[model samples]
Target: MNVPVVTGETTEKHPLEDYLRFDRLPHIWCPGCGLGTVLGAFLRGLLQSGLTPDKVAVVSGIGCTGRSAGYIKLDSFHTTHGRAIAFATGLKLAKPELKVVVFSGDGDLAAIGGNHLIHAGRRNIDLTVLCVNNFNYGMTGGQFGPTTPVAARSTTSRTGNIENPFNMSALAAASGATYVARWTAAQVHQMERSITEALLKRGFSFVEVISPCPTYYGRMNRLPTGLDQMRYYRSNSVVRHGTNPNEVGVGVDGQIVTGKFIDIERPYLPSSGDGNNGG
Candidate 1:
């Protein structure tokens, strides 16, 4: 089957700047936070996807990254904490033609919203999820979350986090997402491609972006700036995809993996007009 191609008329702009609201300049994210980088990539992806602002819906949960929806000049909805996925599901089902994208933090999706995340994938909802995994919960004073590395210090875990982190791409793939990818903020070009493909995918699509929380996570981990943390990923990350869980456990400090882990076609939820399964 021919995948939905994303193209547009030629224009003399930054490609991404055309779709963004410049007046909304000076976003709320803390200085050195990688969420801005992720947002820039998303805008570029949307442009490459050939999705008009009116036809797309960007939803977000509560967090520093959740504030992303506000900056974008598109149809956006800021929902309750950890409920962005649930809200996006309903939006996609109600308007099957609309492209829905959920931007959230690791804690919002993996901790409080984990159940919803899995269920959405299992049901094969036609939606794209961009999960910015900064490891710690930066919005709430840098507490350890599901994506926080083991032995990492946080406000709650002053000594160190004893729990393991969740590999979001693997989790989504296991849960039945048709498209799953993992990338860091350092890989801006690759992340743009992942987001482009995810929006066009028929079933659940997830892209876990390893963004840097320089303000909190960085201060605790000794990486003072988001740029410094990005440099760490650039130098230490091991780019590969589809590796077994046992092989990539705990992501040793220096090895950050980046690639498209899964890209298999899956069934989307039945529309009311489609026959067979009652809608």
Candidate 2:
């Protein structure tokens, strides 16, 4: 379970081969999708945190981001839709020694799995949750979702979405997550740093990753490409560490706020097992 240092510059063998399931190379993600970038950042963050892959277990619910669990070479699970958190919670209680991470999409985590997401935070479970917010349900025809901003176009809301999106970081913090952060795919290294911090921290931790679903979200909103989405992030992202999560809800073409909004000590949910701290 030795993880290799990836310089990320080599193209021949690819620096991150050790972390990926090469048999599944050439992922199903569409051209210009940003999942690959987010995945790379997660792997690099895990490596940088000095956590051995064998001790880590990734869980995911059904969605485009759910494919993340299948792509990682480490012990993983592809749970039922909106059930990744519930599964991960049970896994943690059964074997608290293993570090469990729930990697899933905003639609799956926020819209369907939202109850589990908040309860896990309320109890301060020893888990790291990475929610990729692509602004729509990318895997299911690109419809408007819980995080779809007001006036944003989607297959279901072509004219414009009138509902307001949830501030995920705020939800996590309010639900009692000990660590909360938000970053875009364009800020890879920063996202990696935040992932590393979340992994190393005890108790519930949540990181909301704003990614590009150029195939759907971008196409409906006029971005049309991953690079265009990245440019949009560059132009709109404002790093405001410690800002109130409640004030950072993204809007249609609004300022993309990014930061680690909360970090505080809390008692993690206790497990029946011995010799394993809740984190």
Candidate 3:
């Protein structure tokens, strides 16, 4: 007999209870959405980073991925749309000792919050940014987003999107981020390891996670299910460490180039008025 997961209340403790909120038992992501898997990977990576739970803070913007802040047990904030990075920057500036992380989707981070993303990278602030890219705005009726691949189909682009998507890792590296990497949800182990490394990195670190919006992008583009997308990723992804990030743009039919593109030591610019060091 299959038992339904009890949402509101239950005595059974989950293995991740230490880092997640039990009260928010069931998440709102769709059946095939990769948010849960991404969240799980993040939690594991957090543990691997060896940072004290209390010393870490998570910030998320308005979007499906924004709900992550509410699910985490540590200090977290659900901020305005496209403002997760801004909020995280503020948190880090106010409390430099804290390890701040911005967790949000492509639309929230790369679209509305695009300027903040770039400026933060330019400053090289000591922060880790985990961007979950589902290729479209899954929450807002599957509209084409900043990371939506060219020629990909979405509700807004019924005939096929014509706009070129932003190569997230490339943008991060160009903006002076000290660490930049890309991975898909299908590559969970590597993704988790990358997240941990980003957390441990001293300067601005960005990790772009290609996730599945099976309910939206998949249906419009023929992937249809999370399994299909994962299979595609596993089969089509090419792991090339140090590949030119600009050449790693993912497309509807092109191979997904994944790996750490940059990891260079940069001065961590403290937000405090007196520092000449680069962050």
Candidate 4:
């Protein structure tokens, strides 16, 4: 075997660099955090969706995942806590031509903004929500939030979380989302495909990404590192593409059932007239 020595540094940029803000090269996410992976998948999906960056709007609430809006090279908005969906809804209604996406953490999307989330699905708003569920409030001292797995330890749940976590895919499907899917950060290709599909879907679409919060969530729960959590996902994930959403609920140290749980068309907003868009 002949070996060729190449010592010159390559200056070629990543294909996705064009979709990001170069000025913000160094993001604040912790080492082993999955936000970057999810963001990359979203950007790739956006490119595959055939939508121009100028006509795409990204909205995010306050959290680790919420910072996505700041890095995307689109019309991005860093909205108030638990208000990303509300803001995205208004943007979508005002400019139906624009592709509005709500990118935020589980705490921001399913807790304080729970009402807005369910209503958005109920009204079948024309928006794609990419919720990064790290299973806790990763940005706020690792407190247990609505999606924290039952019996999982958090800052608040020092011993272990008692309440059952919400099945995000199920909630989206039952609430009337036309497209609903769930994937872990490890499933990058699947995540990107789901995102692209959601973007093309006409009615409300929700994609829940199970990410690793190595800094807080993992530290408190004994995972300690992002790799540990990723390993868990790899070993425990079950991909049932057409499984019923209601049958998939995450529990502490339980099998992670992930896939496209729902895909059905529905009338959106003005057409639905459910009047549930009070957010």
**How do the predictions measure up, each by TM-score?**
0.89, 0.93, 0.92, 0.93
lDDT of 4 at 12: 54
lDDT of 1 at 64: 90
Which of candidates 2 and 4 reaches a greater lDDT?
2
Q: Give one digit per residue, the lDDT tens place, for model 3 in 192-252.
A: 9999999988889999999988999998898999999988999999999999898898889
Q: Which residue pairs does candidate 3 place in steric collision?
A: 267-278, 267-279, 268-278, 268-279, 269-279
lDDT of each: 0.82, 0.90, 0.89, 0.88
How many times do residue backbones clash in model 4? 0
Indicate whether candidate 1 or candidate 3 has the larger lDDT: 3
Candidate 4 residues lying further than 4 Å off, grouped into runs, are 1-9, 270-279
Better of 1 and 4 by TM-score: 4
Rank the models by lDDT, top first: 2, 3, 4, 1
**How big is the positional error of residue 260 in model 2, measured in Å on the Cα after superposition?**
0.6
lDDT of 4 by residue, 93-168 (tens): 8767677899998989889999999999989988899999999998778999999988899999999999988888
